[model samples]
Each structure stands twice: as structure tokens, then as C-alpha cells.
Target: MTNITFKNNPITLLGEQVTVGSVAPDFSVLANDLSVRTLADYEGKKKLISVVPSIDTGVCDQQTRKFNEEASKIENAVVLTISNDLPFAQSRWCAASGLDNVVTLSDHKDLSFGMNYGVVIEEMRLLARSVFVLNENNEVVYVEYVNEGTDHPNYDKAIEALKSI
Candidate 1:
């Protein structure tokens, strides 16, 4: 588990911390159409998963947009913006923002991804800010659990790690 903060208030994150070199855990998350999605759905593609508490917040919005822009440049990579926000809200936000490059998924149904990735915020029932990169084999190449939920993740480092893997 990892200790993180929302604003400056400390909170506990549930589940095991994901370490580099481990196989990325598979999880069920919902797409905008309410269809279930998992790692298998992406098959052999490299992945960048951006876990955010909610899509409505400013930081989450910026993070999603930044990744979406980057997704355009990366070949054969899928950028997933995962959140606990409702599917309706996630779809609305993506449509409103014109985000087509990155897929926004909802973990509200079961918190499957949140729990499996050990990013669940115990008190808030939301996800702590985190970024993960998985190579084609689904091995974790990079993992970043932002100590502060409201702060931005190390985007450059994550991308560099992705390139290396």
C-alpha cells in the first residue's frame, strides 16, 4: 500500500503497490458505451494508464489532455485514462473535450482496476493519482503514485520509461 494526500490531508491507499517488472494485473472497467474492457482488449499494444480520482477536476482534465496529445505521436500505443467517475460523466467529459486519442474508462462498477492496481483511496473511494506503463507483454515498465493527489504526475519520466521498455 502507498500513503498519499488529497490537498495536504494524509490518506491510505488500499491493495498492493504495483512494482516494476511484475505483470500488470487485469481489470474490468467500463467504456463510454458501458461495455466492459480489460487488458486483453488491448492485446499486444503498449499502454499508458493514467489513473485519476475523477474526470471533472482540473488536474485530471489536464492530465488526460496531455496524454491524449502524446498518444497521437506514439505508434501502436494505447493511452487509457481510468477514473471512478460514472460512465456517463466520463463520456460527456471526453466528448466535450474532443478527446479521441485516449480512451477514458470507468472503474465505478466494481473498483476492479482501482483495487487491483492498489490505487484505491480508502476513505474517499476514489483513486489516488498514478501513472503506469506496460510493454507489449503486459510487464510493468514504469509506475508512479503521485504523493499528492492534486499534483501533476511525472509525465516526462513515464514517457521516457515507455520508450526504454
Candidate 2:
């Protein structure tokens, strides 16, 4: 039960919270094409999993854009922006932003990623703002469950963790 907040109101989260050194949980999500994507999709590559409640929000927009910019310069790595938004909306947002580097995934259908990562906001049915870095072996190298749902994650630390792997 990871305790977080949205607009100063305490929010409950579902599932077990992952920690550094733990094996990253496998989950299924939908890509922009509506195809199922899972952890195996990026096997043997570093994964930067950026979780957000919704992509259309101001903080989410910035987080995705920032990760997109960073993803382009990274090699053998995949930056994924996961949200509960529909695949259509995720595709549209990526296109409108011209952010082609980061992959936008939708977990609205099953909430697999949300529940596995323990970022699901029980009250609002949204994922809390969080970031996770996984090594090639699917081991979590870094995890940040933002205390405030609207605050920005420690971008530098997450990127450094990915680079360190």
C-alpha cells in the first residue's frame, strides 16, 4: 500500500510496490496500434518505464516530452510512457507533440501495468506519476513513486540509473 496524494488528498494504491533490486513485474499493455505489448517486447534492452495517470495533463505532457527528448540520444534502450489513456488518444498526443522517440503505451484495457507497479489510484482509477528503470535482465535498477501525483519525477536520477546499467 504505497500512500500518495492527488491535490493534497491521500490516495490509496493497489498491488505491491516494487523496490530497487527487485525483479521487475511483467505486464501487458496496448500500443498505439492496439497491439498487445509486454515486458518481453523489449527483452535484453534497458527500459525506462514512465507511468502517468493521463497523458493529456500538463505534468504528463512535460514528462513524456522530456523522456522523448532523452530517449533519442540513448542507445539500446526504450523509453515507454504508460498511461490509462486510450490508444487513439495516446497516438494523437504523440503525433501532435511530434515526439517519436518515446513509445506511448495504454494500460486502460487491463490495468496490468498500473496494478503491477502499484501506482493505481484506487479513488480516481488513475495511475500515479512514477518512473521505473529496468536492466536487461528485467531487474529494477531504480524506482520513483512520486509523492505528489502532479509533481515531476527525478528525471536526472532515472536517466542516470538507465545509463549506469
Worst 10 residues of 1 by lDDT: 67-76
Q: Estimate each model's TM-score.
A: 0.96, 0.96
Q: Candidate 1 regions off by >4 Å?
A: none
lDDT of 2 by residue, 93-114 (tens): 9889976666999999999999
Tens digit of lDDT per residue, candidate 1, span 75-118?
A: 88888999999999998998899766569999998989998999
Residue pairs with colliding backbones in model 1 are: none
lDDT of 1 at 22: 100
lDDT of 1 at 67: 77
Those runs of model 2 whose alpha carbons end farther than 4 Å from true positions after fitting are none
Native-structure RMSD, model 1: 1.1
